[model samples]
Target: MNIETIISKIKNALGEGVDKVSDEVEKSQVFEKFEDSDDKVAKILDDAGKALTSLFDTIADKAEPMIKKTKAKIYEGIFEEYRKDGSPYGETHEGFMQWVDEHETEIREKVDDGITKTRETILSGVKKTQEYINREVSKKEKPSDSVVDGSSVTDQKSSDKE
Candidate 1:
């Protein structure tokens, strides 16, 4: 199945478990004894559970695509290395060792390039998300300010009437 489907299944399973536990806790005698204490305890448990769930969701969201990309790159690198030697494996034990030794620099370069590109891509995405959020916040604030300004004008007009 696809990553999104897998993630959704995981989330649903976790949500069901959370709901079951919450229901059990709500039904307990301990919760019946002290209403205020039960309220606070329930709130704390709910908040902590939600936070943990969110953390796992974030991890899964980030890891799925990264794992796929890394797997593809590793396969590509191995295949390309094999092709260069003109053999599926290697010519000989010594030949394999020599190939590895010779390609150390190139392999390192490719890994470094991949890391740099991945970092830049993640950063760019974060920047774009931040910009979008900021734009939305500004849009919301402008309407709020307009409402306050209108109220102030109405208040001043009333004062001037007096």
Candidate 2:
């Protein structure tokens, strides 16, 4: 082939190679852009999730006291209704209520004393059980007097026979 034709062919091949390389670079850039966008979307979603969780937490915090108050009111209403329907210990609810009101302090003291005595009795029982357990465990852990003194039962029996 002539030099000119050879040179033109080489130039054409180089140009095609450069075009392919450019296309590949463009494709890589597109892929990188998609990855960046996906990361940004994920970050935004995470932030939104966090914000929603915070909002719910704040709502619960603010609503908790109100819910408690409402529950207390409902319980009070139920008790009041029961009282109106006459849950009295004596003849006439008013007299029963008056008697209870008069002896409220004494009743509370008695109840408290009973609770304290019961707690003391339970604690005493528990302590006795613990002491018993400790004694039993210590007996098991210690060597017996016969074993410590190096006298086996058979040796003692033979000595007694002699």
Query: Which candidate wins on TM-score?
Result: 1
Cα lDDT of model 1 by residue, 68-141, tens digit: 98979875775567577686346665666566677788777877888899899999998999999889988774
- Estimated TM-score for each candidate: 0.45, 0.34
Tens digits of per-residue lDDT for model 2 on 1-162? Answer: 764454455447667554343333444453454476446656776899999999989989998998798667654554454466575554566755675576568656765776689679979998999999889989785533333222332334545579
Q: Which segments of candidate 1 are over 4 A away from where they belong?
A: 1-56, 59-62, 65-69, 88-98, 142-162
Clashes of 2: 0
How far in Å is the alpha carbon of 22 misplaced in model 2?
A: 32
lDDT of 2 at 25: 43
**Residue 125 of candidate 2: its Cα lDDT?**
95
